[model samples]
Target: MADRVVAHQGAACWATLFTHAHYLPCLAVLLQSMRACQTRYPLVVMVTETVDARTRERLARMGCVLRDVDAWRVPHADGSLAFERFQNVWTKLRAFELYEYERVVMIDSDMLMCHNMDELFDLPLERGMIAAAFACTCNPKQIPTYPAEWTPRNCGYALRPHPPNDARQLTKPTYRLINSGVVVLEPSQEQQAEIHTFILRHTERVAQYRFPDQDLLADVYRDRIQMLPWYYNALKTLRQCHPDLWNDGEARIIHYILDKPWLLGPSPCGEHTHLHSLWWDAYASLAAHPATLSMTRDEWANEIALHVRGI
Candidate 1:
């Protein structure tokens, strides 16, 4: 994103991205969650050029390390984005360019934290290894817009029990599908350049990827990828669709992959009222913070509640 990401090479940290001001609330809640958990790692918030000054100032005041990003200039054709909502996500590739940190965990902004996950920084990541959880392509809500291949059985984590630790994962690999939502990577200028070259040469193929940057990352790092316990990137739908694999108490982060609770769109995997409450509670804490939500809390809550539907 910046002309160059010159972070010190020995530090490890947490990071996230936001392309626009609308996602400010989600990013705020995530930052608050990190502080709540008392993590030692600093959060480097990557911002696209379009982000407003006020929002930028707010984030700075909250103690986030702001990095300006320039979108990768993907030659996106009509309907090329994996989802209509994923505008400018290609800028996420900028995370890999942060060649300063010894290792960086790029957590997607649209997720909720359950507890501190600082131990992730201490995990074994060899020079070329990129660690992440397998994506649950199980389109549980049966959203017709999603491809038919997104089935429960096709999901890499469907029947596998919760991994005790990284040994079952980092040592011997099982599945190939990797979710880009959460990534623990050792950033390097070489890999960043290689990824840029991959995107440039494979534009047509990369544009058709189901999850844009996600598929591209998988294709590039297939053999070098490692898995964390699913709880690290726990998809919300797992509770309803992959019940056998869902355990709330064990969760480290809850990736709201399908739809964000803040959007109050049709609830993903039916109504997980408790999950919604957790999101709201985090959001509510930021009521006193500057320039967040627009409406009175009661008014917005009532409006959002009406739109949230059960399957």
Candidate 2:
């Protein structure tokens, strides 16, 4: 028989961040989710601002390749919570360029996975981008939707000292809001240039504005992206969209959007105790697992104790 042609299995990378001290457990949740995916991708790369000694040790024990960002080098845009989150993504985008990888998946700490995401890399992200949601606001749909000022400062909305209350609350979803948590980024030289230009121009907008990061991206990549299944980012919205699928034990990922398991624990979705319990059990089990964090019961208790007192 003729020799079979083996497909080229290019390398893929995963990225995430953990700066807020209390979010380490959530980061653990993310790690657990990643571990569940039975892919042979090289080490998962994580970026952090300020991780404590014990937490750092715990992560090291879990076989993660950790990288720390120079806080001084990272510009401090005084206002906006969204900007702080996107900044991590920006850092990952920059770092991914230096690393020689065929593709990279950038996920947020607030997500939980139930299956392998290697399929994301199989898609042609080089042609465009892959996001969970589309555009999710009207501003981006209006005339001249995408403002020229894409960098943090140049964005239409000027930086505000106080967080807008509206921004904090999860208002009604207008357009398809691309879930920044899970995305497939194919890093080519041209793509890197686009990412840099987009961030430099739109970052200020994200910094100064409230909830427009996804909107800005929608505008920028309006014609150059593909939308994956909602379950991929599976949050509260998915529950409403596919009550049966979300509850039918078919979801590949259980994204706890508003009721993040790491912070508040499981949810009470519409009195659906079963669904809520499933989420809780999945999270608790992941938290208790050794692969995620090697913290003992006592150490875990102490960590939460400090959290309760806000120390």
Candidate 3:
């Protein structure tokens, strides 16, 4: 409930990524929700050259500081050093390079803020601390090895099988993976250098991970991470797969996972309809005049192709 401007007093700010023009609507809604909730810190967005000038102007008009960064990539899994399409997810790691900010809480553009989460800035974060909520294990039935007694405290590692004759398996430590959607990071020159070094040292392993940023970060900071309460990042999957854990009143930020309400119409049944309605309501209020920047049919096809390639 505290609305203190702690981040501004220090060097921190709220940051997110704007990689593609198609994401403009989501970013607009996210910014609108942040303003509606009266967030205390300035909102900064990291963008690549691919983002159009008009979108950049719109973001600036919305009072967001725009930062231009080069797109980054990791090697392909097959030990092939071929460069994949630019992945915005990899760009999330650049948050650590904003040395001007002592700390930053990176929120995905797909998220909607229901309350002023300034309290996140007050949470104790050590030099290497990465704070985030545990990704909802809503479909436990699908995970064959999921323990019936699973709780955040006892769920230390989730095993990943290695190929036969892979001696590298002995060096890897399995750790619980945290969702990268909402993360509290303390950015420093040293931390940035460390991440860069890590990427260079384990480029092959990073490329093979299903979720690059999420997996690599969890691997590096697994021991230093502090798990936040689920209310901080209530995943929509919980509402769809595990209704028992869904409570709108307790949720401060609703993250639309696999399915986004903006792109898809509301479902006909269940409480998830209400959650989707919330997203539409925010979108309708903020995206009255959506950005003109849009992908062409061929560009859209290319984007789909790139996604299929998992880059």
Order of candidate numbers by lDDT, starting with the best: 1, 3, 2
Best candidate, lDDT: 1
- TM-score of each model, paired residue for residue: 0.83, 0.67, 0.76
RMSD of 1: 6.0
Which of the predicted structures, 1 or 3, would earn the higher lDDT when compared with the native?
Answer: 1
Report per-prediction Cα RMSD to one decimal: 6.0, 10.0, 9.2
Question: Candidate 3, overall lDDT?
Answer: 0.67
Candidates 1 and 3 compared by TM-score, better number: 1
lDDT of 2 by residue, 1-311 (tens): 32222111566677665565576556665676666677556445454556787766666676666766543223435655333454444454444453466666766666667777667666644354544443222232232423333232322112131111233222323322465666666556876677557657765654544334344455566555456655566654445443444454545665555444434434544543454555566556754654346666676666532342222
lDDT of each: 0.73, 0.52, 0.67
Q: After superposition, how far is residue 282 of candidate 3 from its true place, in Å?
A: 1.2
Candidate 1 ranges beyond 4 A from true positions:
1-9, 159-174, 265-270, 288-311
Q: 2 or 3: which has the higher TM-score?
A: 3
Q: In candidate 1, what residue range of length 10 has the lowest lDDT sum?
A: 302-311
Backbone clash total for model 3 is 0
Candidate numbers sorted by TM-score from highest down: 1, 3, 2
